[model samples]
Target: MTRPAHVLYVAWGFPPARGGGVYRALATSAAFADAGARVTVLTAAREAFERYTAVDAALEAHVHPEVSVRRLPFDWPAREPDRARWSAVRRAAPRVWWRVRKELDRVSFPEVGYGPWRRVLEAGARQVHADRAVDLVVATANPYVDLVAADVLHRDHGVPYVVDYRDAWQLDVFTGRRKHRRGSRVDRLEGRLMRDAREVWFVNEPIRAWHAEQHPAAAALMHVVANGYDPQFAPAPRLEAPDPARPLRFGYIGTMSRQVPLEAFRAGWAAAAARSAEVASATAHLWGHSSHYAVEHPGSSSIPVTPGTPGTPSALPTGGSGGGVVVHGPVSKTAVAEVYAQLDVLLLILGTGRYVTSGKVYEYLASALPVVSVHDPGNAATQVLVDYPLWFPARDLSAEAVATALVSAAAAARTADRATRQACADFALASSREAQLGQRVSALLDAAR
Candidate 1:
């Protein structure tokens, strides 16, 4: 009898680390296991999430019982800094010392904060391979250092490795800017990994296209494996009519980082409120982490902001004007459906550019609420939402444009016809992660054969 293919999957932000990438990582691992591959997940210790980011114990339930999970110690001084435990030299010149330490770490291995983990990971991969043959090495990245371990296994043991880039390493997704200088360590290291990888998966075509251009020789190996919504997290498509007495509640549920145009959203929301009474009375409820960095500083509530322009609506508790933008902060994975059920409309806010596509868009699409997109028209997310019925995209980043979109979207939500609702439900059911990942995982496993 033939044994199952042994797969070693490396993802630093695996389960319990309630970041945006966790869902994608979890889904990928589960897919491999469901495909009957003997999968072992190599990830950072769960304790790291407790100290650095919010933890969702609920996500653990989704993992396939047959999958083996091995957690390694991670030293994230940047995330969980301990001044109390600092060395004399570190305390004396903290900034200088930190910079030097970073340089040293990068020199040893090409990743930050995660560079030192290379030796441990390399050792772990070798041991896993020694115990039983590893047919394929799949490495997903944010801490792209995980790729190094895959590369090590491929070079040493001849195991074919797949590199999965949920986000780019050398390119800034928001600005479409190159982050590294020519011939830099990142450029050299990433080039090496791409050239040797059996296949490389990107979350979108634009990103894959960019990488293809960067590494012409590896272009043929590049594939688009999009980040998609888990059907289980989807709230039943909103069928009820919008309440007329209370203002429409437009909600956003996702992490708010520098990439998210919160200020621009605030301006647009205020302008929309002033222009339309329906919008004026509407409340924009912002949920999820204000910023990933906010976890390090627990006392912080909202992102810092400049005062709103005069004549705009009054500032809300969250820094935005119109008293419409309300920040609810982070919620557990299970509470997501409850939050979605309360919303009359969903706001899809994403960073600008071809490289930027927020994972939250899938959830927004699944919710079936009228969506107001506060993002660049050039954004890759536009491709996904363009065909989606009930999607109202902003004309531009200006407050006037966003306001216009929001007002129009609110009107649509108040009177969404049955056809529009059915279309949304159909679209969501078709775009689920299971539908997306099922064939891709099978193809990948077949390739391993």
Candidate 2:
């Protein structure tokens, strides 16, 4: 028990990918290393980063120094419009799986792009285990296919597996939709893999509750590990201490894809700006990827692209003068707190309701900044931030209500009590991302053995 466990973690988006899960995965693996595990992370390669999402060098540095990572190469450039050179599949991609590809990419998984990565991933898992034997195989999902990779090692080499489900595979946590019908291949596969795993971890309580109801047999294995601020990226001091002078700089960081409801924020902003022109003189800056391939995903907002998508400080909006709205693009994970520091307000904008808990929410709370929520009432982040001093929850999507709420948030920002502020800091301090998972991973490792 005193000696370290050799853990091989299979996560599709680790480090460079700029996918939100990268932070959790990096932190967990790094935490495992800290908790005395000799960790070998079998993650999708740096090439995968340029293909699926933008890269974040700063986030890459956040990976623990002791952790060893193996980069697997993937050819996703075929999905892009112009890069049709190497594979015949790329040239024929248009006709071969045209309809399904569009549909899969539309919904963001299963059909195109990530679907083909299955074999590459399975091979990568085998390569890692073959290179060296492992005691535990942990897989974090969302290319839930990564679980297939872990299953390869488990089924073939008896490397016991744990499935860390940051978000449910088939269940739509936001709307409680099936995301598709039951008994589908993917759903059945997910249920089967989940059933066989040593442990299944989720990021929120409501999500764990829902899974328990669905798979009561596996309920005992399900555990909640809420996303917390990474010690590496956490703000050391209260970000900018309520900067009110030059427009109360409201900010939204992370990928604002189609589901993000940036337009809703815009709708809210339009009304709120007019109502409190004096207060909103500050800009609403967005930092993160606009879409997967530097292309605008169907529902993503077209805004300024600073640093330009992959840690390029993006901000680009086509029309409406964009006077109050700015897209700062993506920021490096290293400078995240510095980014957090400059903003007086944090905007928590997301699409779903069933039980969504964004990784950014933890950092937002940790940033010690005022938060303006544009998510559903049932959203898990709301549960965590209900006690926050300057939280403005837009229970419904009405622009007027959100506008009014913005005014209230502005008022709170101007005059929140010191104790309320301290309470906010205390709450987040207890939930440091690396620290929480360090404890959970210790238990998971013990159980898997």
Candidate 3:
């Protein structure tokens, strides 16, 4: 009898670490385990998630029972807020201390906040391999230090590794610019990693093309594995037509980062309300974290938004003529379906960039609700929604354009029949998380044989 292929999955942000990339990591590991692979995940300790970012304890329950998780201690002195834990140098000459710390971190790896983690990750990967021979290594990156573990295993044991880049290491997706100069340390390191990788995965085609241009030798190995909605977590499409008498609900989910055009959305919402009675009566709901960090600080700008009761509006200022806007703070992953069920339309307000394709796009598509796109037309996300039946894309990021899209979406919400809603849901079926990961898992399993 043949045993299952053993796969080592290395990631820095596993569940309980509630970052945008966590869903992909969770789904990827789960996909492998579901495919009958013996999956072992290497990640940071639970304390690290609690200290650095927000935690979604509910998400841990979704992990496949067959998969095993190994945690490592992570050090992130830069984000430490407790002055009591600070060294004297950090308290006195903080800038100088940080400079020295960054230099020390780069001595092991090129990344600043994550470089020092390389040694620990390597040791952990080695120990895991020592216990049972690893058939393949799949490393997802952002701290990119996780890739070092896969590289270590490949070099030491002749194991093949896959680099799953949730985001680019050299290209800034927000600006579509090179983060590192040509022939710089990051450039050299990334080139080496990609060249040696058996397969390379990216979230979108634009990002994959950018990386391919940078590494022509490994172009054929690169693949675009777009982010998709998880069927287990996403709510079923609301086939019932919205009541004409009641006010419509427009919602936005995911992290509200500094780059998100919140001001534009406010202005647009107000304008839409003024122009259309349907929109004027509609309530806009914003869900998810105010920023990447759970706590607001000097370097971070967590919006001064108050959490509203699940079904009620908050007392906070709505910032525009429309009085129905509510900020509902972060929602747990387990409760996402409930949140979607309450809304009539989705607001896809994203930062401007040609390469930016948010994971929210897939979820919005899955909701089968009228979607108003309040982002740059040039954004890669536009391409994803171009063929979507219910998409109402703004021509530009201007307030007028956003208002126009919002008004159209509102009208759709009121008049859209069940067939139209079902068609929208059907369009999104191809983009489910299981569909996106299945082909890759099958290919990897075949190679393992």
- In terms of lDDT, the poorest run of 10 residues in model 2 is 312-321
Task: Please name the candidate that would achieve the greatest TM-score relative to the true structure.
Answer: 3
Which regions of candidate 1 fall more than 4 Å away from where they truly are?
298-322
Candidate 1's C-alpha lDDT?
0.81
TM-score of each: 0.93, 0.87, 0.96
RMSD of each predicted structure: 4.3, 4.1, 2.4
lDDT of 2 by residue, 267-353 (tens): 888798888974457667777766655445553564333332234322222222365776665667777777776667788988767
Candidate 1 lDDT, tens digit per residue, 127-146?
A: 88988899999999988888
Per-model lDDT: 0.81, 0.73, 0.87
**lDDT preference between candidates 1 and 3, better one:** 3
Model 3 gets an lDDT of 0.87
**Total clashing residue pairs per candidate?**
0, 26, 0
